[model samples]
Target: MPYKPIESYGVIGDMHSVALVGMDGSIDWCCLPHFDSPSIFAAILDDEKGGHFQIVATHEASFKQMYLPDTNVLLTRFLGAEGVGEVCDFMPIHRDKHGNRNGIHQIVRIVRAVRGSIHFRLSCRPAMDFARREHEVVLLPEGAVFDSEGQDVILLSPVPLKEDGKGGVTAEFVVEAGSCVTFALRHADDWTARNDLLSMAIDGEEARSRTVQFWRDWLSKSKYEGRWREMVNRSALVLKLLTFEPTGAIVAAPTTSLPEEIGGVRNWDYRYVWIRDAAFTLYAFLRLGFTEEATQFMEWLRARVSEHDGPSGPLQLMYGIDGRHELPEIDLSHLDGYRGSHPVRVGNLARTQLQLDIYGELIDAVYIYDRHAKRISYDFWCDLRRMVYWVIDNWEREDEGVWEVRNGRRQFVYSKVQCWVALDRALRIADSRSFPIDRPRVIAARDKIYETIMALGYDKERQTFVQVFGENALDASNLIMPLMRFIAADDPRMLGTLDETLKQLVSDSLVYRYELEKGSGLGDGLTGKEGTFSICTFWLVEALARAGRHRQARFIFEKMLTYANHLGLYSEQIGHSGEALGNFPQAFTHLGLVSAAFYLNRVVGKE
Candidate 1:
């Protein structure tokens, strides 16, 4: 079987973990129980060895899938010569009476015929521990059990499932109008359940309805009355779905080892939390009235501050789910790479890099919380004071920028701007709340960062801010300067930077992070090409909108939206042939989409 293109996959998750459902109705990638846990079905990574669970119409059938309106319930319709059937796929949102949440592990797949008649073929193969551990199957009277040395899988299905080779289960049934069937799988480490099959089906249906209701109710609170209502809503939901409910930490993307450059070595595990991703994620949530998510993430951020000491040499760029500092990067050699993308890596090495932008990201989140939440305890302000002081001390240092380039550290233009942002936001906090802090020190830090960035990071000949001090190359990160108000969008230097970026980084209406081949030096170590950075493209759209180029911005914004795969999703980058590459459905990309759409609709509305 040939590999499915990246865009052909849709996602379904139970808050704790997610599964990538292919257009052909096979679950090629799924991590059980937890987002970082071993995948039960990983054919997306190793098509031949990695096991998969597929349920599809056996005949010459065509499928069309979409989410139920205003809900996360995914419905895929299959039409063949004989009949038409619909697969209702959803994970019930487990919530308390007060409307809070917990880890969602169970996925309920129910199939029913809407018209004629369609035959469904079901294959359930639980490849434990990345398909290395094999299991022994036991067929019980009610449910089937697959038990391995350290893992277990229980089949809670309406019909009896026949055992196949290597602990697999297979079932085939025909469903006519008004006929329905259910299949549910739950994972645990040595466990059993006395589940009544009929009641489980009933519970699944109720949970599905409530999950949709929960999303619809939460979405109703959105403060955005913008023009791209559909796009914004979908982006908001995707962001919500990616969040880890137990820890309140959001992963960069759901899937790991999705190649940035196909058959290349740009793969990195993104299941861990990055302070940078979460910081911007907070703002996106706040905009959509997702106060619960925002509050949880802010608390998660505060926990990080409380645990760590001052500065810590430019805080680790990312952390484990429980906020652990040490993330030992490793490569899974056994599993063949996604489309022969060699050396499938797990855990990110960039976590150890000194990305100075994190300082600005943390300070920005603190400022955002202060602005929106309005009440900060004295203790919280004291922590803020320490953060502010640290920024003043560390603003001038050279470190890796946001891209986590492994090359030698340079005075990146975007890092300097963010250092400026750190002080700027700190000043806002001190003034608005009248908190006791060193005012002159902040002013000094702000002015120094501002002056140095302009003097060092700008190219006078090019009339724009360059990627690094004394360089002529433009970076997509420069687009954020205007958005951050480090420079006005109308400022001649800022306009020139935008123009230079368009001339250099953009291709086919998309933007690259930088000249990977050139800027990525030999001593930097890693080698590979990648797709256009989705966030950079959105940043360009935002910069254009701010520069009073609304028409051009809207055109570009709409064009980028079209790049989303079948289910209105985006990854970190778009490959050369427009495949969704990098980590699947990255948060940075979706967050950028929301911000860009909101601005485009807003500015265009004024006209």
Candidate 2:
């Protein structure tokens, strides 16, 4: 089989984990049990050695794929000279009446013929632990089981099958109109537990209907009745899927090591939650009236802060879905990386980096939630106050900025601005709620940050704010100044900064996070170039809309929407040729989409 393009895939999840389903009817990337679990099928990363499960047409067929309306249920249709067939793929949502999710992790696929007789082939190849562990296949009366040391993958099918002689299973069959076959890939700890989950026969039709209803009901809670409904809803659905429902921690993306530059060494694992990303995610959710999600995330954030014993402060940059602190980075040398992007990495090492901007993001999210969702508990407020003091004490120090640049830290202007944001929001919260605190100290610190930034961070000669202090290079992140209310959007300084950024960091409306020109020393400690950042492009859209450039913002916003994949999904970046680079269905990109769409609609609607 040939390799599929990164964007030629759709994703489905049970809110605990996700699987990447290709247009050619194959599951190329799926982490078992949880979002951070080791891959069981990873052909997307290593097509030759990584295992996969495929239900493909026997003969050449043209394909069309889409998600069922308002739901995550995916349908891929195949049309050939012989017949027409469709594959319906979804993960069943087993929720109780109380609106809590049950622990059912499975991917169900139903193959059915819609026209004349059609022939199909089914193949199941399980590579446990990223193909590092050996497994034994045990044939069962109902299906087959691939059992490793601690994990068991059960493949239950209602068709006859034969061993492929390579420790896998394969089946070939033909179906006429109105005929259908069902397959379920269930993951469990052992064979006993696997059998228990399979004991109850799942009515495929009933499960599909219920899953669709579950998504529709959840989406109905959205209060966004604005323009671009389809695109906005699709972005919302992707965000929902990326969220780890158990802990309310949203992973940045499901798959890891998808290169930002093809064959470049820039790939890093994104299957963990970052404080900045999660906070922005909460802000987006709140904008759409999804207060329940916002409140849940606030609870999660409070727990992370209260349980902190580390000297690094209240939180790390990122954490595992279950709030595990230690995420050691490792390389999978055995399996070749995606497109041979060498040294496939797992577990991000950036988690331990001191990213001071996280404090600002965290505090800002709490303030937004308090006003838009609900009141913060007194205990939570006390914890936030301590976090504020930490910021006040350490605001002058330099750390990794929002981009998580691997190069040695400098006095990033964005970081200092966020520290100002932290103190500013804290003061507002205190005054509005009359919370007891050191108001005088907070006010003085906030003013000090503003003064320092204006004095050192701004470059008078360039008439713009630079990427860092004492430099002339521009960055798209500085565009957040007006959005954060650090400066007025139409202020002369902000307008100059915006124009300089568009000139230096933008190419045809697509924005780069920063310039990597030689001798600029701002390549982020990586080799090779990268695609235009989708999030930064959307940031530009938001900045333009907020600056009263309504016509220009609408033009760029509409053009950017055309870059999304056929299913209205976005990866982290877009190559020069308009191909999606980096991890697929990135949460940050989608959050940007949601936010830009919301603000653009409001601004354009008023006109």
Candidate 3:
């Protein structure tokens, strides 16, 4: 099979891990057990070697995919010359009494003929450990089991299977209208064909009904009744799926090594949780009235921060879902990257880099959470206080900004502005919540940050803020200054900077992070070009709407919506030709969409 476009897939998850189901009824990319677990099928990255499970029809047909209304259950329809058939795909989500997702890790597929008689072919191929490890299959009367070194995966179905030319199993079946088949792929437990397969398959329909209810019940917490309710709700659903429920750590995306540029060396693993991205997601959750998630993440953040060594700050930039901090970057060179993008990478090295902006993002999230969700415990306040002091002491330091550029640290303008934001929010929290803070010391440090940014970060000649303290290069991240409340949106300086960004960094409603071409001399210490950053484009929409340019913001917002995939999903970036160029169902981009839609819709509704 050929590689499908990144956007040609819909995602289904149980808040632990996700699977990318292609339009052709194939499970092309999935990391079982957990989002960061080794891939069970990575055929999207290397179609020849990586394994996939497919249940496609035998007859020639066109395919259409959609989610069941208000739920993550995906339904793919086969418009065939012989008969009409549909496949329902979902990962069953079982909730505890407290409404938390605590269930088995599995994928359930239901194949049914919607019209006349239809013929179907089922293929099950398992490639453990990102397809680098070999496995043996044990055929059974109930189903088949793919046994790896120690981990085993079982595919339980009602049909008979046989080994194929490749080390996989295949089956064929024909069914008339009103008939169906069920398949469940899950991690092996004590249950076997004699004990559980029959009952599990029998419970497939009940499980599907339960999973759909779980999602709908969760989505009922949304308070948004906006002009683009569907889009906002979809983004909310994507954010919820990316959330790691066990610890409340939200992943940036499920799959990794999906390049920012096709065949370019920009691919990096995003399965881990970054503090800044999670903070952004927190804001979205709070806005949509998902306070339970916000409260859970705050607890996660407090516990994670307590584990950090108290030298420079209270937390690292990112961490594993289970709170592991030592994320060493590794290159998986054997498996061909998506579209042969070389040197597929697994851990993130940027965690070790000094990203001072995280303090601002983290504290800002705390402030919002404290205001909108619930009061923070004194213990949580103590953890945040240490981080505030750290910012006061180190806000003048040069470090990676929000973009996490590879270029050697300079006095990035965005970083300094965020430092100002950290102190400003701290002051607000102290006043509002009666928390004890070093009033005089923090105020002095906050004033110094603001003064330094205005003097050195601004370029008087260009009438705009520059990327670095002493340079005039424009960056899309500075578009966030007003949104952070560090500057007024309609201020003359901010307006000038906004114009400079549109002229220098934006094209056709898509915004690039920074100039990638060397002639611009804004080198990020990386080679090759990249797509327009989708998160920043939404940031622009929010910024423009807040600036009172309602018409311009609405137009840009509408145009960007066209770039979404058929399922209303977005990746990290958009390629030059409008293809999704980075990891699919990106949480950062989805949260941006929610934020933009909320702010834009609010202001427009008032008019």
Candidate 1 residues 289-344, lDDT tens each?
78888888877777777655633453577988777787777888998888998777
Regions of candidate 1 where Cα sits further than 4 Å from its true position: 96-104, 192-202, 310-314, 518-525, 605-607
- After aligning candidate 1 to the native by TM-score, how far in Å is the CA of 61 from where it should be? 1.1
Name the weakest run of 10 consecutive residues (lDDT summed) in model 3. 189-198
Q: After superposition, how far is residue 589 of candidate 1 from its true place, in Å?
A: 0.7
Candidate 3, pairs of clashing residues: none
Q: Which of candidates 2 and 3 reaches a greater TM-score? A: 2
lDDT of 3 by residue, 1-607 (tens): 8889999999999988999999999999898789998889999888878889999888999999999988999999899889899899999998778866545688999999999999999988878888788888888777887877656788887889999967689999987898888899987534453245434554678889999998999999999998999998899999999999889999999998999888888898999999999999999999999999998898888887677664335677889999898889988888898999977888999888788888889889999999988988888887778878888878878887777878778888888888888999989999998999999999999999999999998989989888888887888898899999988999999999889889989999999987665234756777788999999999899889888998889899999999999999999999989999988889999999999998998787443
Clashing pairs in 2: none
Summarize candidate 2's per-residue lDDT along 357-394 as a digit string, tens digits: 88888888889999988998888889889989988999
Q: In candidate 2, where is summed lDDT lowest over 10 consecutive residues?
A: 518-527
Candidate 3: which stretches are off by over 4 Å?
A: 96-102, 189-202, 310-312, 518-520, 605-607
If both were scored by TM-score, which would come out higher, candidate 1 or candidate 3?
Answer: 3
Q: How much is the lDDT of residue 176 in candidate 2?
A: 86
> Each candidate's TM vs. the true structure?
0.95, 0.98, 0.97
Q: Residue 183 of model 2: what lDDT? A: 88
Model 3 TM-score relative to the real fold? 0.97
